[model samples]
Target: MNKNLRQTDQPLRQILTKPEVSSRMTKWAVELAEHDIGYRSRTAIKAQALADFLVEGASLAMTGQDSPPSGERSGEPWILFVDGASSKEGSGAGLLLISPTGEELTYALRFDFPASNTEAGLADSPPDGYNRGQSQERSQLVVLQVRGEYEAKEDVMKKYLAKVREVIALFDIFEIERVSISQNKRADALSKLASSSFAHLSKEVLVEVVKQKSIDQVQVLAIDSSATWMTSLMNFLNSGVLPGDKTEAYRLQFRAAKYAYAGGTLYRRSYLSPWLKCMTPEEGDYVLREVHEGLCAAHVGSRVLAKKCLLLGYYWPSVFQDAAALVQKCRACQVHAPLCHQPARKMVPIHSPWPFAQWGIDLLDPFPRAPGRYEYLEVAIDYFTKWMEAEPLATISGRQFRISSGET
Candidate 1:
């Protein structure tokens, strides 16, 4: 009856010859069409329905869902995620809040400091005046983006767990029934007014935060594509045993290349892909190209690659031989030679039975004893006891005469 159905008449004729096959196909088409219509609508409704059914089916499922009574519970814990930026001109900090109801609240500060997340394009100049949406905002922007981008990555599960731990620390603050986060101090202040601490609330009454469902998977595809795996592999190689071969080296090179292609250049002159900026490489071609070029540049049948391989390090910058040689021959390093410290002085304590244990002896010569007499004085003291003896001599070298006088 339908034009689309008419096109399938040849297959249907064959099926018609076998009444059983025709019956099955007709039933299958009806069921498939019905399923298609139902499936589209069910995507949203079905998940909620399933959740409700599961919650109803088991009382234990609702255990983690309990919210304390508002009167008994402290005001909701407020979280402020701050993003900051810094430049030669100044610095800025930005904040964001996630409410219990999945609302996003944002705030920004422009000022100066040694705040977190200062690195950006690595250029010497700031682009323009401060604006809320400007990327030129600097450190705050970079850190926030980094945090968000990092959270979007697959390897951020441990970090995400850490954030959860941080949020849990609020239990020390108040009887937290609900948790909210703000980018603005105003929201934080408001929440603080509601409940400054959650310590008064029972552990059972404190509601476990319902994390944003999309956060776990946020910008995931972009994150995976842009992620440079070389550093991770390099870390593994440094901390553990890495298999030796062209394959391993090639893998490392690939990661470097991808990073370079992704604007992770030592010179900071590389192109930035908007797609890559979002979170990941839109196409894997850049990564492949980067890897190939990196391997060629690093390996090129030289000992530089070998020297690099022998080193075990974390986050060591990728330095070619020229850079290594420059660092080695640095004037400051040559002039400031490595320290060679003198041995520590050994403590030698002075000991005596009464006072001084020993005394020193000396001679004073060429002294005028009288108007016409040239003379010397023989002086002695007990080394430890400090007892002194002195004798006036008519001439130098009168040791024999002094001894005869019983100076001892």
Candidate 2:
């Protein structure tokens, strides 16, 4: 009870149980690390317990006893044990709610079994000669089989009578005689009802949904153990898995230490515990020289080999950019290179005026000739200084091709 509410203020817990108030609370430990003294930073411990229940009012100290119903609150209902293993079969759960300080009550995530007989009522049953009903109409015929034929049993009995009138309008029966119950035990009861049915407004929202499902199951087992540790460090760094005589790079780091001890035993019951034994053998020869020098300069994928194994160090660095863009788009140098086209555009330079300018002529042809001399070769050109002139035409009639276009 927070040490019986700090020993009921025995002179402010003997001046905060002093040694000069623990050396002035260790020289004002970072301005009294205020989680109302329990210590945590980002504020809101339920807005400091509703600012100590609006500056100590609701008849003050309930748990201490301004009014505690003195008995029957019993125990149970602070459950939260989740388990989700996967090498195929693994799922455990058990959850109870109401601890989120019920201001409007809400809790979900349920594999909804016989949840306290669907919250009492006994999950419906009782027809064939209605065993003379009475117990509140057999608990309204188990709330019409706990509204099962898929809801609408008079709209789930008018939404469970409007959640019993919004939980008696935010508590009143003396704050339900200042309710108090606490229990936690797992490893059974389906992981304590899957970690107590899920009611969270704090405990950092159930420890950020169990640290985001343990970072989505350690990012899917660190992407299948980084593709079996980059295919056992590229087949022991390119073909050398203890075949020939002399050993090398310690037989490729003893076959990348048996694929990094079977990918660190599939992330050893992971939450990345013991941080995958910090991978070693000089971090698998610096991730096999950054995936063979990034697949020989420019083609590494698995998100560039998980960003070159986290810039050559790795702390579970997982890129897997859609499995490195499906391995550099199934390379064959990106599926056979050859798809270039862009050539067409030129004209406008008819400037002459003199000095063999503007001239233009062309007629070149002669091959395997001299036997009967019919292959002609006469050329003359000068389109504004691209000058040239030659002749070897013995027959290209039509007046020798109009005197070879007036000899340039």
Candidate 3:
């Protein structure tokens, strides 16, 4: 019996001495000790309490415990931050739409022309959702915050204010609040970034924010079929039929050869020249305004303005007349007209009969002093022969002139 007990004890001792076996037994002993002390139950209870606290905190945050007072909470107002920046490069407007839940949507718009800060601000129209076929009730309360006080004192700003009022009428509740520049820095930064040459915007964000319309998307003007000037040309291009009258028929035939229809637009062809764009009276006027004083205009003269219109491949019967009238009526051109350098009187030619007979003399002084204290030059020129004679003199004496000219 003692030998059998010793054999079992020997096997147990060997198992305890091995590293892997000893580590496994030590882990089980620690787990058993913890279970006996009710540590697992305490840990589970603490975890469940932590989870409840997290769920309660999330619920309170979603319900907005720190929301506005009940009196002002009838309609939750969305905060709108707007700013405009004007610089030599360009003008831009920025707007920030901040939801009640703290989500923000930013937009930056670049103007076609350089504008003043107030004008730039005025250029910003309400977003499509606010302005599009939606009823006033559908429009949410908006709190507009700007950095500067909005005063429509100026005549131009008055028009802008009128537009702003129109936009304001769309909302059921709207309030304009003036904030400090420091508080509106984000909108200001967006405007400045838009005015800069390069924009640091992600492609995905720009795809959602920027709205670009293609040229083909714009509606073209409908030309009247009974229009007097264009009716004959349109008929000739559409159908190769001329009037029965000899004079009208011959005229139509000659003009029809020069005109052709391409993509629904009438174009006049010329020898060794690209087709000229045919425009109606209203279209001609618009072209003149655009080329003469539009965004990239230098406010050129009437003749150059007319030439520019033609060079741009546009043509009309009264193009020169329209361009001249437009330039004459331009307020900016009238106010900033440059001074004319033309002489008041006509220049008359001076005649000389002989070379030596018509000599003109003049004196030049205050030159560097020479060895003989000469500081003046006497210049004589024969007007007829175009010969000149110059001599440095110490003093203006009649004897020196006689001696220099070889006169006794």
Candidate 4:
């Protein structure tokens, strides 16, 4: 259809088709290079019947679709196909909405930032546009986490899932199923088009470039600073105030003996050591991250890591457990750690094939300076035969031992 639309008049074609033409015509000819076509004059109609046939055939050949229906339209639900693509060129997604009348509308969407493949048709409300033409009782959503079927791993997508859930809650009936690539060609083509570096297209395809995640609008959260774990202890230490409950006050008094406030920081008294600065879980997490993988840190084991923090004058109740959890979650530690090998069953012993089949050599020193100026004795033993031979040497050297029991 694009070729048919770009088909030009005789004079214009002559200019564009010429071997030597203007720069503009040369560019047009290059764009139309794949289309090797020439115009032919339409013959004069012989009769009314023949003329009607030619006109109708020409119209059908030009547009390849019948004129819109005059009355009621098709009532089939418009099926939608979606696919995602990611490459070095860019990350993108595409949607292909097929009308009940077999008309296809393809969308090419480009993402501005790097992330796992997202629903190309998701951010765009493709269903809302077809409200006038399709069923309205319920909407089916098929997520084409396609290509890799990527899970929503990124925080942006995780947050986006909440919004998607809220919208999906309104649907009465919905169904989703994995579809083969053959059935999703249109959307896949559009996805590739958006993700590739092809700057020129035969037909003008307007790509919707999403500059940022739609769900990333800033949100303000109110956090209570005075309600933390140490808040009560700090209040009691700063001022002589206690909670209204006698049991709670008694417990606070018992725990407070071990905690000392100094330099505007809470410290816990350590046995045979200086006071350890007590840390909240949040601060403890930062301490753990830095100390575990920080400069000069060798990614030590959990027990050692916790001990290091304790030795550094920091205290947290879950320090040991947190260190263990951090080590488990550490990507480098998991990927590059040494492998463990354990025997599947009890050990077994084996006997040698024959006497002197294998030989062992050993060195012994100092025999009061032998005739060859050798101080060490090199001994050979046969595993099966218990045969032994010895030679004296003074200096260590790298050479094959000549066994007295077997072929050298």
Error of 3 at 138 (Å): 23
Compared with the true structure, what per-residue lDDT tens digits does model 2 show for residues 296-328? 644444555555554544433234433354455
By summed lDDT, which 10 consecutive residues of candidate 1 come out lowest?
120-129
Better of 2 and 3 by TM-score: 3
Off by over 4 Å in 4: 1-223, 338-408
**Candidate achieving higher lDDT, 1 or 2:** 2
Tens digits of per-residue lDDT, candidate 1, 1-408, equal 222223332354455444566566766565444332211111235788889888786776565467554422544444434333444544344444444344665543333222223321111112122111111122333334333443423333344434443443434442112122332344333222213232332343322222232123355354434445344443443454354787976766555443322344221122542222211122222322232234543222223432332231111233344334443454554565557586688778755556445545577877767644637777777756678778666666556455724655
Ranking by lDDT: 4, 3, 2, 1
217-257 per-residue lDDT for model 4 (tens digits): 57789987556677788888988678999999999988888
User: How many backbone clashes can be found in candidate 1?
Assistant: 32
Top-lDDT candidate index:
4
Which segments of candidate 1 are over 4 A away from where they belong?
1-357, 369-374, 383-385, 401-405
Candidate 2 local distance difference test against the native: 0.40
Pairs of residues at least 3 apart in sequence or in different chains that clash in candidate 3: none
Error of 3 at 193 (Å): 45
Q: Return the candidate ranking by TM-score, descending.
A: 3, 4, 2, 1
Candidate 3 residue-wise lDDT, 1-408, digit = tens: 122213232344444434467776666555443332211111234888889999999999977967865534544566777777788877776778765556788878776565687666665655433321211111111122121343446765566556556676686666565566777887777777776643565443331222431211366799755574666787777876677899998888887787888777888787777889898889899888888778998999989999898888988888888888898999999999998898999999889987678888888887999999998888888999879988888888898887766631
For model 4, how many clashes? 1
Clashing pairs in 4: 376-393
